[model samples]
Target: MEKTKYSLGYRNSYVLQQYRCLLSIFTGFIILLFISNTAFALATNPGAVCSNGFSQGSLTNADYTNLVSAVNTNNYVNILGNAGGSIPLQVKMTTVESSTNTVKSNFGVITTAGTSAINIQRTFPNISAYTDIIFDFRNALTSQPIYLTNVALSAFDIDYANSNGNTFDDFVEITGVTQAGSTISGTLQPITGSNIVFGQPPQGLQGLFTRTASDPNCTAKNLGTQCQGSVQFSQPVASVKVRYTNTGYLNSATNQEIDLRVDNYCYVPQYIFTGTVFDDNGGITAAQANATNDDITSSGSIYTNKPNYFNGVFNSPQESGISGSTVKLVNCANTATTYATQIVNTGSPIGQYQFSVPIATFNNNTNICLIEEYSGTAYPIRTTSDNKNTGFTTTTYLYSNNDFGRVIAANAALVLKKAQYINNCPNTLNYTDPSLNTANNGDPKTGFSTGSISNMTPGQCIAYRITATNRANIGINNFVMKDILQKQGVNGATVTSVLTNPPLSTTDYTISENPAIGVNGEIKTKSLTLTSRSKRDFYFNTKYGTTVDTQ
Candidate 1:
């Protein structure tokens, strides 16, 4: 009776096999029956898996196949049809200004390698109106730190299938990044399995995802909100302000110079098939050398003499295109075990290239040093100033507090201000400071104050402003004011000096406005008078005019 129930009730097939495995794991067989019932109820009818533009499947492309082939196989694809099928790859360069106001090179590149393949599979079920497609980057080399400088732009052709030809308006145009490479594989892994967390949909995809701006009330106040709406609600003008830690160069040197920027546009997809090999147990089959060899074999021994027999095919123009470029290949093992010089003209016209310090041929060139921004507290992104330190530019970015000298930093500002002062000021009038002090505490007796100056270039203008306090209130009958100018550490006797006259009476200095005076404002010299508390503040101004000769 048990055998009859097992055989008759659940026909032994792939679905049955999975159910039996679930039943075996459960102590109470009743729960297994309930679970199976739920799965069956939730499962869409064979033709109804895709409705209203929703798809559920793995992402990735493990072969070098077009979007059409990938879609028919029921795999995820990023379908991008060429506006015109001339060249599938594109590259562009732009100039961008850095924070220091220096202009540097920015690069952008685009290709229909992986994204189209995934979109094709997603849109295959409806050959009419294409819906939202997912790009699986789980199996991609995303772990590698990529300093992405260029933004990706892409679109699709939905009506291509119905019109029997590609058209501009057939597919919805959406800009995004899939796999950043020349050739894409045909196998894709689900993001859930690959541990990739889904982030907020990009700017352009908000409309497709049915999303509105975060702040409706801020519409009038924010320029970004208005600007974002202008570009199809996708290409926000402030997209440049969007920052992602995951994107851009990782482990970059403190002040490493990235002279060449490469722009990238890519499409990747995954496909499913049924045969002797189970889907879970299958692995990627490499593309053969020729089209004739594009067939499955029991022994898997089909071989074509093409250069890309086992390796992925590079469909780029310009033979041996990237002759001088190089790429580092790594595996999940996290080892720098392999490196390959890029093959030129095999995939893209301007292939990948590596940069290094230009070789020096002249003698005494050892003194010529190159400055690199270093990681440190003073100049967090300041130049490292390299001569022959680390040989490799591939090191990670590191910084410390000691990277910048506080003394140098503090002194730099002073020097700059002094230079500005000298350039803007002229020495034509007289000035005074006394107390026989080179430090310029000021000639209190003479009412002149002068500050010590260093690194003063010849012909540089110097000036001084002096202020006097309590001159009339002081009981001391005699007071002297003097100014001294001399080279630091020089003989004081030889230094030039100036002096002001002594007070003849109690009202030696006059004030237009005094705040220290009391309401009983008699001439109270014996007691605390306004003149006793009176203070003076002076400022110096030396505008360039005719020069004066000091004899």
Candidate 2:
């Protein structure tokens, strides 16, 4: 029972607080884990990152051969070289001695090594796989200097073996040099060799080489002269075709062989995405934009007049209420025939406008326009009489349900109907027609335009309230409906008096004539229950511009 006191040290308290914080964090993390497990899962799509089939990198000579094999049956590669120029330019592992390999001094590899006997060397890392191969070279002798002539490229399965067994058969000889040189080098090295073994003479490995007898300095012979032996090493190739000159050379003074190398090649697919364009006109059926030789081509509709954006499709004002409108997706650039055509129906909903058009149709250079067919002669007419109406002269009148009030009621209904779209949905949306406003001279008119809302969400409670007042005069019976003649033209022209019926909803608020412009000149205030049905009808009217305006 003695007084016992316990003192907590500052250091101990700090440590204890840290431990408590850690424990609380650990508990919170565990709770978070449980919540996450219950939630939806999301991961990046694999195709979104890597969609190509082959890994991208430079291929070796052997690897290149494999690629050629892969694409052999398909003819995927496009070769660019002379008629006999495109042979495998890969290094041969076997060594060639001076005796086994023939070398002409004037035509052979004038190696910087400068040895009497040149041993052809085959470098390692031999193969360079490519879609195809190209070959380009220059002669060792010419009247002016060294230049290429009678250029041709040949493709074969073997890199070093020539049809004649002597690689010289693959030689594309040039005949316009005056040098007294001898010996031709026929070394086939992928990294660096000149000799290409093109088999067989009838196989047409050698393109014709010519020379003019007039030029004394041009002593180069057609077959041999300074013709360096061909170098034939091969990398794997998807294709082996020769791109050669069928015409003249320096001797002809009109053409000359090109100096080049099978520097690089590529193998790419034809098309990436496929889809179509839909006919979204007010009435007609839609068509698709499809792929044509790696490109998107579309055949569809044309805009004869201004376009109308109703719901999701592009419609025409002229064809808005017209039945059996025709539409198709066509390539605007092509003077070609249309692909598909469909009949469009009048008053069709937005979502039902187009069918079967793929998403890729939007990517093409297709133009979407509305071709409207004129339906009727009696079009909408405009008027100029301050279209608003007023009751007879009276000082203080009880306000009756008039055209203006009815218009306001209609608007209120629309507010309810479009509430969901304004609050939650982001994309453009449309609604059906609402019941006509019957109050006084008010006529229901439908319209389409962008809309927005505030203080509500889709599936939430909505209400409509209206208040009407006469600021100038009061104390008389101001009715809501009236049949008054209005001149819709200049001056007091022709007048058409029409009686307006009240709106459909009986649920409404009416404020009798009041003494107050209340606060801010507001004479009366009416509040009505805005039910879900009212909202739907109201939104419908808004789309068609039928909703009337009130006070």
> Which candidate number has the best lDDT?
2
364-433 in candidate 1: lDDT tens per residue? 1222211222223431211111221222221211111111111112111101011112232323322323
lDDT of 2 by residue, 75-156 (tens): 2222222212212122111111223222212211111112111111221111110011222221111111111211212111
Q: After the best TM-score superposition of candidate 2, give how far the Cα of residue 329 lies from its true spot, in angstroms.
A: 20
Quote the lDDT for 39 in model 2. Answer: 26
Q: Give the whole-model CA lDDT for all candidates, comma-separated.
A: 0.23, 0.23
Quote model 1's TM-score.
0.17
Report the Cα lDDT for residue 170, model 2. 17
Best TM-score goes to which candidate?
A: 2
What TM-score number comes out for model 2?
0.21
